[model samples]
Target: MKAILPGSAADTDKPVVLGEAAEPEPAADEAVVAVEAYSVNRGETFQLDGGLERRWAGWRPGKDVAGTVIRAAADGTGPAAGTRVVAHPPAYGWAERVAVPTASLAELPDSLDAVTAAALPLAGITALRLLRAAGPLAGRRVLLTGASGGVGHYLTELAAASGAEITAVTATAERGARLLPLGAVELITSVDEAQGPYDVVFESVGGASLPAALAQLASGGQLVWFGQASREPVALNFFDFFKGPNQARITHFDYTTSDTTYGQDLTALVRLVAAGRLHPEIGSVRDWSRTADIITDLRGRNIRGNAVLTVG
Candidate 1:
């Protein structure tokens, strides 16, 4: 089968390619999915495109996948064989087929298609986890960064549904327009421009934006740091928090290490999609082999939302 592998290091323009690899076998508690499609993530681009050293240069490189289960878990845990499911592979998912833990598999309802289901796993799970980390969002003042992103879009809608007074931040006013109905009470181009005293901040963009978000936190507020799309390190003085007027709680959430149960969150997200309440903003639904172009565009922040790749 063909899988997406890291591009040649000597080449600067292209950053990914389709490479041939043997099919994988499922473990006792895992299922092998015949991948129909998958979504390209910003973090995946960062990890593959010369950002991290590659010992296995020609290995698979996708995180989310949706397809029919060709092989059921040996333990008889998850869905039976032939069940349509969406999964978040720990790594190496960009292949004709991939194996994922049964606990992380979510059965898709007949209402949802593979293209949309493929876009949900990583981004949806992250959004759900962030909301959980931030505590109850209802009746709270929330400020969200990267409002137009894949996770950002889901976060905005979910937070809004919780009755939080949301202030969304985007890079441009044009992109801010779509976020308004998604639960954003007010829209701004940057975190520094938002009103202070927010009860919670769903921060994904780090670097300069991190300091501005921290400064705006209300007393006893929680700042959930997830992704640093800015690709910049975050640093600040002790006085900014220890002696600051509003002492906010700063928390970091990593999906791989976070205590949030994968099956639980994934099931909830799938339900939302089936109910027509959750609309995944899918962009650039293209061939999987075009991954090189997708990587280049994501690193440039040119792709506004999640880019879905149809696999077969």
Candidate 2:
């Protein structure tokens, strides 16, 4: 099989290169998926960068993938062989074939293509779980930051469908404009520009944005911190919480801890896509041979939404 590996540690550019991978040995509860397509994420690029002090010497970087099942789980826990599906592999999904746990794989509807299904795993699951954590969205004021990435696109649409009024924060006017059709009612350049007293806040751009978003929450409102895209630590004084919204709560969110499995959420997302309700904003698609260039585009923030690489 073929896969993507991080560039040489000495290389400052941190490019991803095509490489050979061992044939997958599926466990009793895992299926062997003949990967057709996979998506790139900003976090994976961050880990691929050699500048990071703690590097996994042979770590394979990939999370979301879609393909046909070549072999079903021996335990008969998931779909049978030949089923078309989207899967969240524990690792090494950037390959021609991958071993995916049954719990993390979902059969895709015939109406959904591999490219679109490939974009739904990580970002879509995270967005769905985040909304679940926030609870009841109907008639609520929901503020979302970093509202231009793949996760942002899904979160905006999902929250809006739940009847929540969404205020999306994006760095560029062009990027923000893309969210309007997805259901964001308001757009702003920064958290400082958001209208106050939001009922629920979905914040991902950490650093200064976290505190700013925190201050904007209404009393008893919930702020869910999901990512630190800015790569900066937050510094807050005790009095920062003493401001207007005294009872506001800031909760850290991680999708892995949620009660729902990846397959469960992926199934829901796939159904929505089949019914023309959810849209996967795939901004770029290229051959797997161009993985290096795709990583560069992701690192530079050039791709607007999800970037998919297909096996060829």
Candidate 3:
């Protein structure tokens, strides 16, 4: 087996060095996947920067994976060997092969390829949970900030399918145009000029945009804060909460939880992909050996959609 190793936070140049390692065998409750493809998330950069901490506390940098089960636990409660599946691995997913608990794996529909399936887990789950927290999306005037990235694209599609009228905010005209076919009812390049008073505001970009998003929400509306793309601190006014005639709700999303919800989310995503409701827009696909360059491209925000590394 081959894997990428990161020594420390300061060593940014090609942090993922390919090296041969022994193939992992599944534990009693684990399964070994022959990784076919994996998607990169923005948080991977934070992990590289030593900003985001990992559950396993090691520095291998891949998270969402779709692949075939090469070996399963003896109990057979997991996917059978040779079954195609996607999983939210315990650690971030940067590897040629991974050993994960069977609970993390979700069966992929025949219509969804490993590459696209790889794009679903983290981003898809976050979108589902965000929309659920926002309540029934039907007929709601929804505002999506930073609606051009991985999670943003999925959020847009999911919200649209639920019959929400979506207004998407992007940083550039080019990115804004990309959202037109993705079900964005309106595109606003400048947040300041955005006509809102939306029923729900999905805030993926934080910092100045957080307060801006909150301002756009209609009284009694809800705001779901998911990411901090700007990486800036957000300021809020306490008096605004009580002074407003209508009630307002603010919620933050965290996807780190039990494997059951993770599996359910991926399964729903696979079904959406099969039904032509969710199509993952991939910005770039690179060979496994070019992991460092992929991370650099992602960090620069030069890539759009979810970036996948084809391991095969």
Candidate 1 structure quality by residue, lDDT tens digits, 124-223: 9988878878888889999899888899889988989988999999999876677887778999998878988889888888898887898888888888
C-alpha lDDT of all candidate models, in order: 0.84, 0.88, 0.81
Q: What is the per-residue lDDT of model 2 for residues 1-312, given as tens digits with 9 covering 90 to 100?
A: 678877775574647778887888888999999999999988887777743443455578889999999999999899999999999986789999999999998998888999999999999999999998999999999999999999999999999999999999999878878889989999999888888889998888889998899888888999999988777788776786776587888887888888889899889999998998899999999999888888888766788889999997
Q: Ten consecutive residues with minimal summed lDDT in candidate 2?
A: 50-59
TM for candidate 3 is: 0.93
lDDT of 2 at 156: 94
Candidate 2 TM-score, true structure as reference? 0.96
| Per-residue lDDT of model 3, residues 1-312, tens digit only | 687776557877765677766666667888888899998888877777677775464447767998999888776778889899999886646677888777777998787888889888888888888877788989989999988888889989888989999999888878667677888899887668778788998887888888877877788898888888877888877786566526877887776743346777778888888988888888888887887888888777788788898986
Q: Best candidate, lDDT-wise?
A: 2
How does candidate 1 score on lDDT?
0.84
- Work out the TM-score per prediction: 0.94, 0.96, 0.93
Q: Sort by TM-score, best first: what order?
A: 2, 1, 3
- Number of the candidate with higher TM-score, 2 or 3: 2
- 190: Cα error in model 1, Å: 1.3
| Collision pairs in model 3 | 62-92, 62-93, 62-94, 63-93
Residue pair clashes in candidate 1: none
Write the number of the candidate with greater lDDT, choosing between 1 and 3: 1
Q: Could you report the Cα RMSD, in angstroms, for every candidate shown?
A: 1.8, 1.6, 2.0
| Angstrom error at residue 271, model 1 | 0.5
After superposing candidate 1, which stretches have Cα over 4 Å from the reference?
Answer: 52-59, 258-260
